[model samples]
Target: MNFKDYIRVIPDFPKPGIRFKDITTLLKNGPAYQAAIEAMKQQVAELEIDVIAGPEARGFVIGAPLALALGVGFVPIRKSGKLPGETVEADYDLEYGKDKLAVHKDAIAPGQKVLIADDLLATGGTIETTVKLIQKLGGEVVGAAFLIELSYLQGRSKLGSVPVRSLVTF
Candidate 1:
């Protein structure tokens, strides 16, 4: 299935001159949602991921299901103070300002392989920080996956050598 066909392109969303690829439409469609998950699963099946780490909000939507499909634990990388107990944080730059992302201190065991998941890959700021948080807790990032990628933003550049997999591009 061409999942991208289900995505809605909204012009000037949250800002001017930005064409936002909204996934809400796709999420509401049963077949499209399944196709997306299946596509992502195929990409990471060979990675041997020990856990799936998803960024705040949207990432949780896709990442949780992906983790379940892979039979792995799901770790959430969220904004500061969102998680219980001890946590580690990584600060990063955004197009507008700066922000920090944190993960449970013991969420990822040392030397375990982690696969980062998100709904979209924009500028890679959040993903980069998430990767840093995982490494800080001693988890190796096996691969980073996204449901959609805005290729023009060049988000992958910030990710360096980490393997990146996206189901759809625009």
Candidate 2:
């Protein structure tokens, strides 16, 4: 399927000179949403994924369903203090400053294989920080998946050896 057809692109969104790719259009369409997740599932079908991890908000939308499709558990990587109990945190540089993400200290077991999923891969800061949190807990990152990727941002470069798959790119 032509996934881009289901996405809405708004120019100068959130800032001037920026075009935001919105997946809410596709997400609202049952067929398109299912197809997108199925397509992403196929992309990582060969990976040894014990669990799927995604950042808060949009990432949860993609990752949870993907995990269900793959028959694996889903873990949420949230902003600091969003999670209860003990947690592991990683700080990453934002465009203007630094922000932190945390996962419950016991969310990922040592040596478990994990696949990171999100709605987009832009500058890679979130995913990079997610990788750190997983590694800090001794979880092996097997691959990363996305619904859309801003290739010009070169976010994948920051992931090092972790493989990546995206259903759509802009």
Candidate 3:
């Protein structure tokens, strides 16, 4: 399937000189969304993943279903304080400043295999921080998956050896 056909690109969104590749168009279409998840599942099918962890908001949209499709548990990695109880947090640099993400301290049992999922990979800071949180809890990050990736930004390089897969790139 030509996944790109399902996405909508908005020029100068959120700021000038930026073109946002929006997946809501594809997400609203049941068949397209299903196909995207199925394709992502296939991309990581060979991995021995025990759980899928994703950041809040958009990450939930991709990770939850991908976990269901892969028949694995899903873990939500959220902004600091969004999760109650004990949590592990990692700080990352944003365009302007730093932000933190957290996960329930017990979300992943020690040594459990994990795959990070998100809507997009832009600068890689978010996923990199997620990787830290997972590792801090002793989860081994097996792979990272995305619905879209901005290749020009070179976000994948920040992930080191962690394999990354995206349904579409712009």
Instruction: Report per-prediction Cα RMSD to one decimal.
Output: 0.9, 0.6, 0.7
> On a 0 to 100 scale, what is the lDDT of residue 13 in model 2?
93
* TM-score (all chains, Cα) for each model: 0.97, 0.98, 0.98
lDDT for residue 166 in candidate 1, whole number 0-100: 95
For model 3, residues 5-46, the per-residue Cα lDDT tens digits are 999999999899898888889999999999999999999999
Once fitted onto the true fold, the runs of candidate 1 whose alpha carbons sit more than 4 angstroms away are none
Which is the better candidate, 1 or 3, if ranked by TM-score?
Answer: 3
Candidate 3 residue pairs in clash (backbone atoms < 3 Å) = none
Residues 1-170, model 1: lDDT tens digits: 88878999999987998888999999999888987898899999889899999998999999999999889999988898888879898898877788888988889999999999999999888998898899998899999999999999899998999999999998
Q: What is the lDDT of residue 85 in candidate 3?
A: 84
Candidate 2: residue pairs that collide = none
Per-residue lDDT tens digits for candidate 2, residues 1-170, read 99999999999997999999989999999999999999999999999999999998899999999999999999999999999889989898988998899999999999999999999999998999999999999999999999999999999999999999999999
